[model samples]
Target: MADSTSQPPRKLAPPRFIPPALSETAYPALKTGSGFVSRNVTVRAWGGDEKLSDTQRVQASGLAGCISGTTGGLMRGPRNILPGAFVFTLGGILGQLGLNKYLRHQAQQPAPGPQEPLTERILSSKWSPFSRLSDEKYIEIMEEKILRAEADIALIDDRISDLRLKIQERDQRASTDINK
Candidate 1:
């Protein structure tokens, strides 16, 4: 049997519904579509697509450079901003071109052979003072340097001897003149 103190269950209210009216939805859809179109147009104008040729890639890089320079100049405030932008734009183009050239050069170089011994690898590394120079080559280079130094020293000695002879001749003439 139910307890006499029990109360009846209460019913909850249903959720409110908002209708999708064209006036409310159309503006946002149009805004989003326009933004999408604008982005695509800007990217196309900048040659930013992946299928671009080398010339196109360079042009895109130049555009990127120009944008970067303009932003940098703006960040620095009003003084000489135009000049700064021009300088940075030029720098960016030249720097990117140089980087591309270096990368192409590196790509064209032959790949290294199979794994080398640890000692050989370490010795041949760019950080090593003896990079690419074998013991025989190092010795040959040192010998050449030594020969050059010796020749220079010989020339210096000859000059000193000639100066000494001139001094002796001058002193003898001075003494004879004094004795006269």
Candidate 2:
């Protein structure tokens, strides 16, 4: 007979990511001309830099759009059409562009030419920026970036929750507004 107290161990695979909630007060802030675009860019850029596949990146982008639209739909004009899906698409595009910029920056670095100093010579230097930080520094910097991204993601979730509450409050007020 199988042991009643001991259960089969669950498998642990890749990490599951949950995005942050949108805030209600943020709706006006998000809907502002450049504010919305900047928010989308920030979210999508973080997604691109992380381990997410292209499909997942696309999904993140879409969610960003939906968050904006749904949060404001109640008070927005009929022509104030903000779509979650469309905004997500745009966000993804912007992320790709940012990624391309990084790639191009790397490619532009010159290869070791004959005129360049040899490894030993460069090592002997006392004032080189390259020598100041070792490979460990790069890893540390990367870790800091991941932490910031995680915080931003958490913010997104909080915003989303706030947005929901705002929607409910708005709904409650709508009847009075119409009657007035």
RMSD (Å) per prediction: 23.6, 36.6
Instruction: Encode model 1's per-residue lDDT on 1-180: one tens digit a residue.
Output: 999999889897533222345536653444344434543554587655666655555555555555555544444445545765577557656766787788789989999789889989888788888667779999999999999999999999999999999999999999999999
Residue 70's C-alpha lDDT in candidate 2?
48
Candidate 2 whole-model C-alpha lDDT, 0 to 1: 0.62
Q: At residue 34, what lDDT does model 2 achieve?
A: 38
lDDT of each: 0.66, 0.62
> Which stretches in model 1 have alpha-carbon errors above 4 Å?
1-50, 117-120, 123-180
TM-score of 2: 0.27
lDDT of 1: 0.66
Q: What lDDT tens digits, residue by residue, belong to model 2 across residues 115-159?
A: 645765676677654553578998999999999999999999999
